[model samples]
Target: MSSLKSICIIDDDKIYTYGVSKIIKNYLPGNDVMSFENGKKALSAIKEMEQNNDELPDLILLDIDMPEMNGWDFLNEFQSIRDKVNKEIQIFVISSRIDQKNQEIYRVEWDQKVDDFIQKPVQVEALKDLLA
Candidate 1:
């Protein structure tokens, strides 16, 4: 598998963000890892990077629920600017609210927009498999 150059995690939970970032760093040392407390911050930062012609993240793990701008809102905003992006981005929706109905809805509405929908408390093995 190809090594990822950078990763971004958009979530409000500090513990989950820290744990996921640590796992990513452990697997891909020297990789660029960024975390945001909400989608609004992540979206703004990404847009700024685009405007500056700076490097963008290779992957993003987004949470469904957040204080400012949820994952769905982020995706909608991202779609508008996706064509202007300098690099390809792989997005994964990571949420703890994965019931059968929610899973079905995600599969129907976001299957093509995102790479995958993963349950929270994201595991190293699962991440390794996906990243691999």
Candidate 2:
């Protein structure tokens, strides 16, 4: 896979973030990986970047459940700035929820917007695939 300049991870779990960030750093040294505990903070930062006309991250690792603003809420708000943000910015949904019905719903509902959905306890292989 080609190198990514930057990636953003928006998840509430610190351990998960730490683990994923570590793995990413190990695999792709020098890549800028930013993590946010909630969607609101991430959104605010993205908006600020937009205002500054700065380039967006190449990918966003988004978690479905979070406080203040969940993944779905983030998507709703993100839609407003869709044009402003780089269209190449891919969003990958990561969640622990294993409900097949919920998965099907999200697949159908957000297929066009979200690049992919990954179940939690995110695998290194899965991350590799994404990076690929």
Error of 2 at 16 (Å): 0.4
- What's the lDDT of the predicted structure labeled candidate 1? 0.87
Q: In candidate 2, how many Å is residue 30 off?
A: 2.5
Q: Candidate 1 on 1-132: residue-level lDDT in tens?
A: 557668889999999999988987888577789999998999999999888988888889999999979999999998866777656789999999987788888889887779888998788998787677
TM-scores, each model vs. reference: 0.92, 0.93
Cα-based lDDT at residue 120, candidate 1: 80
Give the lDDT of residue 132 in candidate 1: 72
lDDT, candidate 2, 44-90, per-residue tens: 99899888988878889999899999999999898788866546778
The whole-model lDDT of each prediction reads 0.87, 0.88
Query: In model 1, which regions exceed 4 Å deviation?
Result: none
Worst ten in a row by lDDT for model 2 = 79-88
